[model samples]
Target: MQFKNIISGAAVLLASAPAVMALGSATVVNNCGYPIYFASVGQSQHANMQPLQGSYSEGYSQQGVGISIKLAPNNTVGGPVSQFEFTWANGKIAYDLSNIDGYPFSAGGMQVVPSTQGDSSNPTCVPVDCPAGQSVCTAAYNAPDDVRTMVCDENTSLTLTMCPGGSAKRSVEVREHIRYRVHARHFTVEQ
Candidate 1:
């Protein structure tokens, strides 16, 4: 009888208490004038993430977790409106911003910036920091501005915005991660 009562009490308590799930936090900032929908490509394994933080942004989870968020301009995901918050595992990621279409006429571009060291996924990433208002695809023969790589090993903030005019992009990190980033000409992703 005592055992039964104890079990029932425990059940009640458990049922009353909310379920706490563990997830990593990652933030994507929008510095662009227009809105952008950002999505995180799932990794077979979540590398090594820790300490879940903030709510899921744009339906992104370590995997099989929460509803994806439809990111909008100025609105933030997995973080405050100003900056993005990332779970540990999701926090550390490698991404690049490049002009896939060598459209010589296109002037818009994106720049990938990271706090620590980062590397490019493209071998032909002839790193060149082209400022905003300038062109990355030069004459279609020459390579556009260098591709930008970012690695947020620690729980840090990553800003995704249009390439600023004549911004200097840097790269200095081992190819430890395999993430992809491609900036299409005046493009938006809806997934």
Candidate 2:
């Protein structure tokens, strides 16, 4: 009877653990000429707006539930922003590039590359490549119900690059209505 109780308790503990525990780390790299700000939103711990200059990388880990890393050209919130969204569940990481709000980095472009080839069981596992100046990229989510999500192995880390090749000329207008907020620390930035 004691053994049975122990087994049941163990099962409960495992079930309660956050699914994001299976997810690998995520790294965001800024390759654009100007500084870009990023913030994380969703079930995981929220991150405040933080700046990343050219040629710098930021690494972070997500907790349970879904998370979206939003990027903007300036250190503000609530404007046209590009997002890298993901959820880790059942040993797979489902991810997508979201432009539903707007594509603030259309002039520079962005890419999300998984460290490993997508698991053979999933066909939608592939890198999201939004070319420079492409305001409407089909590879990313344009609407709420867009079928653009991709899946990869649970252990596969991701590298999100802004302006993949080199610095892109700024073409998007920085709207004046954006709400400014104080920056907070939640991730490690590497040069």
Instruction: Give the runs in model 2 whose Cα sits over 4 Å from its true position.
Output: 1-23, 44-47, 53-64, 174-191
Off by over 4 Å in 1: 1-91, 101-108, 115-130, 137-148, 163-191
lDDT of 1 at 131: 42
- Mind giving the per-residue lDDT tens digits that candidate 2 earns over 75-138? 7767788898888777778889999988988888999998887467766667899998877988
Native-to-model Cα distance after best TM-score fit, residue 125 in candidate 1, in Å:
17
**What TM-score, computed on C-alpha atoms, does each candidate reach?**
0.31, 0.72
Q: Give the Å shift of residue 129 in candidate 2.
A: 0.7
Give the winner by TM-score: 2
Q: lDDT per prediction?
A: 0.35, 0.80
